[model samples]
Target: MSSANLDPLSRNLLIGVLALAGTLASFAATTAPIQAAQRGAYEVTLPRTLDASGRGIVSGTMWCSEGARCAAPANGERAVSLCGEVASQFGEVSRFAGPQGELGSDDLARCNAAVVRR
Candidate 1:
């Protein structure tokens, strides 16, 4: 079939898919270093209080220690709670808005949920 004969919606969908793939690739490339750095050492502190939305606010002072021995908290409710807290904090930051922000929220939730299972 001739390219010009394709429906506009189909063409748009094709373009959108390509765009999404490109974006994903670009993000992976850019995030590789940051991910590597995060792998080195990290910590997240849980807050005692929850926001109006019932989400925990992580204290800025709380941080992961740098070292190979440091490990994330064991999975279960604790992990889900931690992820919820991180997601909440990220939500509060306006800069994190959009697809990237959504991904961040999902990541936090998954991490927390995984912890609960552990």
Candidate 2:
């Protein structure tokens, strides 16, 4: 039978099936991991400053990494979160303004020194 002879519901079902198939094909094509291997590194830096309430302000850059996913926070801030394998090795580093009651130089050093395998 010709498509024009098909009922509205049947036509709609066919269209939906075709659209679904097209979407699945496109997704499969783009989702395959590229054979090319990407490698890189990053550097993070923060300013040594204190706020009125004694919270540390930090700013830094990340390079090599795919994105700016590993940089410190900006001014008027107290702390920032670090993560990934690097963070695990280096203990999460969060710079706070003022005197950290329990967190001191030793803690900072340990955290900053953490290294993670790629």
Candidate 3:
């Protein structure tokens, strides 16, 4: 009835089960943050009459223009994606308005600020 009385094979099997459970727990802990990071937050500035919820009816497709600076590894792409996700949730589709030519530091600052606000 105890580990001392169990056969060698039974003891090994119990150890293996315990090891597997520990491995699974550690794996979940490490991947939680990565999954959350991938789903970046986007703060959209809707008209004063509208909110993230589809309360105020905007009767047209939403437009989003990504600047050239967004292609960099910074918060550009993620913010745009977040905007798309939120827009879709509120029953409005989004289309990119081509590249933003001649982006400056102010552009990146505004983009990064939106993400932080989300």
Candidate 4:
């Protein structure tokens, strides 16, 4: 029932399992950000810098500067999907480059659709 009631071998085995689990958890925690830092790999460039007030957008991408550039870590989302996210946050995306390559004219057109026309 309690630790005091457990034999030495059993207790050692339990400790080993717990330690292993902790190590695994720690490993996952550290590896996630690294993986996130190197995924989807899409960069979105807008027509102009963000308004003087907005310096960056972090909600949808890894880092988006006010200078009309955004890089999305996008996890496993399709390039098209990430382009939409960047466009929605930073305005129409003029270019989107991902793992395979840059989006084609048609795909770029679709990616810009997320931008609200003012």
Candidate 5:
């Protein structure tokens, strides 16, 4: 039945449903473009070498590139989320660790790669 011919209660319910849907559509439209425009990327390096027993050792540093193409949330918490996403691109976070032995002493080669912004 047409909304105009429906009871007051039914008419109000229909209107509310339509309004809620419209609000959701607007929200999606507004955010989709913003997310697409915000571009950012990061690179994580891992060093691998065989140990005395022939097991491989993995460790390295993470680097992020900055510029107009690289965009991340200005907010601290949200920015951290972006950083987490960047890190995930490489692999799990556990793969990254500090120098295994003595403090501030690592014998591995340094990572000098740059991140390309998305």
Candidate 6:
């Protein structure tokens, strides 16, 4: 129903409720994006495409798809450590970039060392 048909008291109440809802919606909108911005992301380029088997993914936080691409939420971890996990799951990382920036050559070497010896 339209607010114009309401009694004055009910109209004011409805306006107050809508204003409060708008305030809450705006507050929620601000905070959610801020939290997401604070949590940086990780992207990886693998040396090869992961097999279509379940082994392709690293963890719940990391998602692998579309051939050699993988991504995860950085979640305050170092590039080196996160890269190691990705390398361990999939294989050597062709490129690893995260909140702390891309892994250096030495770091990449160390990260790849965690690869399973299979």
Ranking 1 against 6 by TM-score, winner: 6
Task: Specify the poorest-scoring 10-residue window by lDDT in model 2.
Answer: 35-44
The sequence of per-residue lDDT tens digits that candidate 2 reaches over residues 1-118 is 8879999999999999999999999987876533211212223322322222222222332212122123222222222223232344323445322222223556445545553332
Q: TM-score-based ranking, best first?
A: 6, 4, 3, 5, 1, 2
Q: After best superposition, candidate 5 residue 112: deviation in angstroms?
A: 17
Q: What is the lDDT of candidate 4?
A: 0.75
Regarding lDDT, does 1 or 2 come out ahead? 1
Report the C-alpha lDDT of model 6 over 17-95, residue by residue, as the tens digit. Answer: 9999999999999898788777878888887877774234454574655578877666776678777877877778878
True-vs-predicted CA distance for residue 80, candidate 3, Å: 11
Q: For residue 45, what is the lDDT in candidate 6?
A: 89
Residue 92 alpha-carbon offset, candidate 2, angstroms: 44
Candidate 4 at 93: error in angstroms?
2.2
Clashes of 6: 0
TM-score of 4: 0.59
Output the better candidate (2/6) by TM-score: 6
For candidate 3, list the clashing residue pairs, or say none. Answer: none
Q: Show model 1 residue runs off by greater than 4 Å.
A: 41-118
lDDT of 3 by residue, 1-118 (tens): 7899989999999999999999999999999878756654233343223333243222232333232111121244434444444444332322222233332344444434443555
> Which 10-residue window in model 4 sums to the lowest lDDT?
53-62
User: Where is model 3 poorest over a 10-residue stretch in terms of lDDT?
Assistant: 65-74
Residue 35 Cα positional deviation in candidate 5, in Å, after optimal superposition: 0.6
| Candidate 2: regions farther than 4 A off | 34-118
* TM-score, prediction 5: 0.34
